[model samples]
Target chain A: MTIFNRLNPGNTANAAPNPQGRQTMPDNTANQATAPESKRPQAVAQPLYAAAGTGGPMTSVISKALKITGQLESTENIQVDGQIEGDVRGLSVKVGNGARVKGTVYGDEVELAGTVDGKIEAKKVVLTGTARMQGDVIHQDIRIESGAYIDGHCKPDFGKGGKASQPSLKAVAGEKTSAA
Target chain B: MPHVTHLCIIPFGVRRGLSLESETPFMFTLARTVNGKPAFARGADQDVSHLGPGLTATGLFETDGELYVYGAISGRVDAARLIIAPGGVVDGDVVAQDVRIAGRFSGRIFAPHVTIDETGNVKGRVFHTTVTVAHGARIDGRMPWRPQSYFETLKELPETYA
Candidate 1:
């Protein structure tokens, strides 16, 4: 909690004048005068999640405490520091240290520092020193660092033939082509 | 999972296993202590999960810590404290100790404490022991008040409402 307080100094400063401003407003004109002011703090009081709605770069974070037991699809980058029990589709997927994924991960660029129990299909894949991949990886380019454990085949067949025909993967490829 | 139709009684303040703090300025605080006990035994960092706006998830999400949803979720969510931030959309059942909504929620909420902010739009039943609805919040269903024990002993959600 102290960390949050320290992180949101600007919000605390904005909130300090709120109560005093409300009390000083005349009762008759309070409705009109306080309306706009009341809305400002509500917007500012939101510490971290507020920026997600204001047209910022939307990178989805699956923190360490969460466990999602289903499919996750994202158009933006995804950083997983938690446990996921299903397929994940993202633009750039980063499996952080201590994270675990139990299903397939489809992305343009996939970075692994943790463990994946299933398959990975991407154009570019990076397996860090701490990565423990227990399933096959299909990628066009891959980098496996020392100390990385891989128990399955590393197939460089991504985006070749039917593998790229999947709807989600096609959408990702289409987005990339259109963006380029 | 029992189908029992009872009157909706709004309990203002009552004793429970987990004590609810009095009205505070901040919507939530990540206190180290939970229920008067140390939250972590290993001095681990507090786990706060955030589902950003660009994500869409379908399934059950379970966490012992706080969950902030800024994305679209369709399924069940279980957390100690859940916050649906503005622009977030959730469509499913939620089981939590404390639930705060500042976004769009369309499902059943089973919690001891619930708070709906001004921008919150709720379209389903809420089962709570205590609840707060801010001005300009839109709610389209009933909020049934149950005892704190009701949530503590809830193993299965009653499917009659769905």
Candidate 2:
């Protein structure tokens, strides 16, 4: 079947073609990672928009046994193996497997492989094998591995009243819905 | 690594601009050196060419191109643009006046301007006058330093340019 070029507002020059043997340009490496977060490829005609190469979160690794007294602000990736007594602002953050954080985390993706004693506001949160948390969680997606401990409220970011954005829940670690 | 002394030129076809569609895998084989340099064997029945600065080529499909491991490539690629397609691997540093990356690239990259697409994964360091990275594309390195200008590219022209 031929897909006639429709003069619509949401058509793209690089639209997916049919099974016809027409040669297609290779997928531009530019449209890889973060592009899926925003404007994904949909069958329905919505305003086609995607933000690429915006230089994702700035990251830093805190190794020694120091402390952050004030607000820890960043726009990159960060790995913490020390102690913090403040708030964190960035993208994905990981508490090292041998560190402790005593503050609130505000970011997109937060992975805790160590210990946290505060609150968290993230889109995707992961608790690895060696993680221990005693705080509240507000997240869209979460992954808790075996042998992890948590001592606070785990509120699913269900948009409103448990109605999540996705039709079906994306079970990460083989289990569907459980707050533990 | 031995410093590149010279660059060889080969012609395949002439076009104003070329874009490699993803349907077919792009290949560039360096058959022989224009300067009679010894060619190292990377694979059997492979095209061979030395990658370096101040080099130019006319028209050659990227059936196979030299992969620079820890060296630098500073030159003007006219009519022939090295297209690193999706999953395409460039093992060394790449320095070009005009470049477009749409695959996986390792080592350092130096260009006046670079466009890294989503499927593009770059590791190592980079230096450019201008840079642009599309979403989903990844750069696992730092912006190190810039290369020579297009004017300096002409400095080697006393033998080839002038």
lDDT (C-alpha) at residue A16 in model 2 = 48
Q: What lDDT tens digits, residue by residue, belong to model 2 across residues A72-111? A: 4445666666555556555577787866777676667889
Calculate DockQ per candidate and list them.
0.41, 0.02
Number of clashing pairs per prediction, in order: 0, 41
Q: What digit string (tens of lDDT, one per residue) describes model 1 on residues B79-161?
A: 77789998899999998778999899998998888999888999999999899888789999989999876765566678876
lDDT of each: 0.76, 0.47
**Model 1 compared with the native: what TM-score?**
0.74
Kindly list the interface RMSD, in angstroms, of each predicted candidate in the order they appear.
Answer: 4.0, 22.5
Q: For the second chain of model 1, what is the TM-score against the true structure's chain B?
A: 0.74
Q: Per-residue lDDT of A82-115 in model 1, one digit per residue for the tens?
A: 8898889988999999899998899999999999
The TM-score leader among the candidates is: 1
